[model samples]
Target: ISIIYISSNHIAAASEQLSTTSQQVSQGASEQASSSEEISASMEQMVANIQNNTESAKQAEAIAFKSVEGIRKGYDSTTYALNSMKKIAEKVSIIGDIAFQTNILALNAAVEAARAGEHGKGFAVVAAEVRKLAERSRLAAEEIDRITHDGVKIADEAGRLLSEIVPEIEKTARLVQEIAAASMEQNAGADQINSAIQQLNQITQQNVAASEEMASGAEELNSQAQQLIDIVSFFNIGERETLKTLSNLRNDTRKIAQKTTTPNTEFWKSKRTKSKPKPAEGIDIKLSSNSDDTNYERF
Candidate 1:
């Protein structure tokens, strides 16, 4: 009975401790689940931001490509215009040469008219007018030549600038493409992280469920321990009743020994023997009932 009492106390204390520990574990698991969920949400947001960045990078790369293409086209047009200006300059030079030759021819005609005397006076006047026209043509050609030369120089400068700009634009496009690729990689990594976080959240939820089960088991164990304690109390009460019965039997034996002539040892022994069987039977029945209750609780 003492052993049973000690064991019942131990079991009750252990069950209470287990219940406390299980509650703590359940609370911790729930907190972990909440934290995991928050982390998963944050990861999802990061993934979305990464996706947006990837898209923006792609758009920037496309714009860079278009700018590069436009630059190349502009460079080609500038080169063609430069060539055309050079051709115009050449034509203007040719016109200037022809104008100079015409001026020389007009001077020679004027000299010939001066040699032909009064009949040549009218031809000299015509020659003088032709010389004036030739001079004006030469002056106009010279001005055109000067303007064409300036145009050619300007065109060449524009072509050179365009040529320099083309390579820089291409480089920018390439850099933009690299940035886009990096952004895509980052986006993929973010998605992977998000997946991992989601998996962690799921595991955390499982842990919470397990912890809750453990807590429930602890509660059940505590109830079983309470029942065992009640059984132990009953056993303690039975032990007290057996002690009182033994005390009463000893008093009766003393009275019987005083009244009888024979020895009281056999009587006391017989009564003790008979009383032991009844308590033993009662203890067995109680134990059997307790065992059945324990088995039922376990099931």
Candidate 2:
């Protein structure tokens, strides 16, 4: 019985250790899952940031395109203005030439009248006014030419600058578009990472639940072990012959006691006191036995 009790205790301890190990593994799996979930959430947030950046890049590209378009329109309008100025200058020069010819004819008339003395004086004064008007017209035409030339040079320079700027702006737009595309790809990748993390989180939850079940199982095993210990505490069989001897003794004693029609506790106690005690650990046989047989020996 002592050896059996020791073996049973060892079995219970081993069972408890196994159960504890199972629970620990389950808990570790659950913790790992939780860590994976955290990583996944971080990835998801990063993806969201990438998406936002992509959108911003796209918007910047659109603004650059609009700016380039506006610059091109301005260049076109400036070129048209330069052409108009050239035409106006040509017309002014023509008017100046016509005025000079009219002034020459008036001077010739004035010279002819001068030979007539007093009669040509008024005509000479009219001729002088005509020459002055012609000179003023010529000066105005020259000024117009000078202004047109300067305007053309300035406009040409502006157009050249605008042409250079257009390509640079286009390049910037392309770069921005590329950035947006890259950002979009990054966002997609992040989304995938996040999804994987979510799956990990789900797996972790399952692990946690499994761990809880394992712990519960361990508790149940511990309870069962305790119950087994309680049951084992009642049995005594330190030796093989000791069990046999105890059984024979119990049978004879019961036979003797049953001979009396009324079996009482006092008679049973007296019989038990008369018999030599089996051993320190006692024996597995009960003094009275029917269908149910239970034996207990106090320390």
Candidate 3:
């Protein structure tokens, strides 16, 4: 019984050690889990930031494209306006030519009418008015032509500038697209990091669970050792029926105790007992359970 009590004390000490180790491990795991969770959250936030930046870049590209398109349209309208102006100038020149020929015919009619005396006087005056009107029309047409040519030159220069601007804008848009692509890649990388952190957190949780299980097993072993010490008092006479079993039980417990002190030994060796083992000092051996059929450590 004294030996059993000693064994119980050893078990309790072992259990206390195990509990301490388990708590340390659990605390370590908790800290690691918290760190992993924080890292995961940070990675997720990075992914979100990347996504938002990519979206913003895309929007900027879209606006740039719209601006380029607007410039192109303006160029096209200017070209069209220049062409219409040229056509109008051509029509004005045609009108000027017709007026000049009408003025020449009126002068010839006036000369024929002048040979007819008083009738010639009124006819010559009418011809003079026709000549003055034709001269004014010719001057107006020349002025329109000059203005149209200048407008065409300005339109051409504007079109050239538009052409340069469009390509530059296109290049800018491509650059923006590349930036967006890079952002998307960063977002993907962040997601992968977050996933890895989550996996680490899960592993940390498993470690904590394993540590708790180990601690609990040690406490239960300590409790059973105390129970064995109490039951040893019931067999002071060392009954024949329980003598062998008790001997085996003592040998098994001793082996377990040895294992706690020894390294590189098999736990399976705890099941074996010598042919005859003495009862612990000052106590008779008794068995609550047989050692041969039952493996206490298996629990």
Candidate 4:
């Protein structure tokens, strides 16, 4: 009887402590669920922002590609212009050579006319004028050749600079493409993480609900333990028949000590939280049926 009383008392106290711990676990689970939900929302927003940034990077990459194409065309045009200027300079040099040949022929004619004396003196003046015209033509051709050469140099430099720019723009485009790809990958990773967090939050909520139900079960168990302590006094060490009868009635309890059992109208209610917990489903706490046992045979 003393052992039964001690075990019953310990069970009841442990049940109460279990109920308190379960409530704390439920509350902590609820907070964890709420926090998980908030983190999921924030992660969703971050994914959206990353999508926007990825789109922006794609646009920039496209623009860079266009710039590269445009520069490539310009470079080709500059190279063509440089080649054309070089050809023009060559033609001008040819014209200068022709003028020099004409001047040399005119000088030879003047010398021959001088050798012919009085008859060739009239042709001397014409030869001298021819030489002068040829010299002036050679000077004009030289000036044109110099201008064309300078133009060729400028065009070549432009082509070279444009070639440099093309590589740079192409490099920039590649970098932008890489950035866009990385952002998309990051968005995918974030989406997967957010999904996992959502699942975890759901599991946490279920755990919180289970913990609440467990607390209710522990509360009911505590009530039954206290009631079992009530009937322990009937245990005896007398005649075998009487002891057998008591053994047959072993551990059976009545709904006695109603005054001592403080009924919790809102058993799951907490001062910190106003939310009402759902009923403890699947935990059957059977109470003694209301009946007046008039005969001693029932005892």
Query: What is the C-alpha local distance difference test score of each model?
Result: 0.79, 0.77, 0.76, 0.81
Ranked candidates (TM-score, high to low): 1, 2, 4, 3
TM-score per prediction, in order, is 0.74, 0.70, 0.60, 0.61
Tell me the lDDT of model 3 at 37.
83
Identify the leading candidate in terms of lDDT: 4
Q: Which candidate number maximizes TM-score? A: 1
- Model 1: worst 10 consecutive residues (lDDT sum): 279-288
Candidate 1 clash figure, as a count: 0
Candidate that beats the other on lDDT, 2 or 4, i.e. the better one: 4
Q: Compute the lDDT of residue 98 as modeled in candidate 4.
A: 92
Model 2 TM-score, all chains together: 0.70
TM-score of 1: 0.74
lDDT measured at residue 69 in model 4 versus the true structure, 0 to 100: 92
- Stretches of candidate 4 off by over 4 Å are 1-8, 98-136, 164-168, 216-299
lDDT of 4 by residue, 1-299 (tens): 54455578889999999999999999999899999999999999998999999899999999999999999999989999998998899899999999999999999999999999999998999999999999999999999998998898899889989988998999999999999999999989999998999899989989999999999999999999978776643343234444444443452223223323644543223312434443652222222344333322323
In Å, residue 88's CA in model 3 sits off its true spot by 3.6
Which portions of model 3 miss their true places by more than 4 Å?
Answer: 1-15, 56-70, 90-117, 218-299
Model 1 over residues 93-132: C-alpha lDDT tens digits? 8888888888898899989999999879999898888888
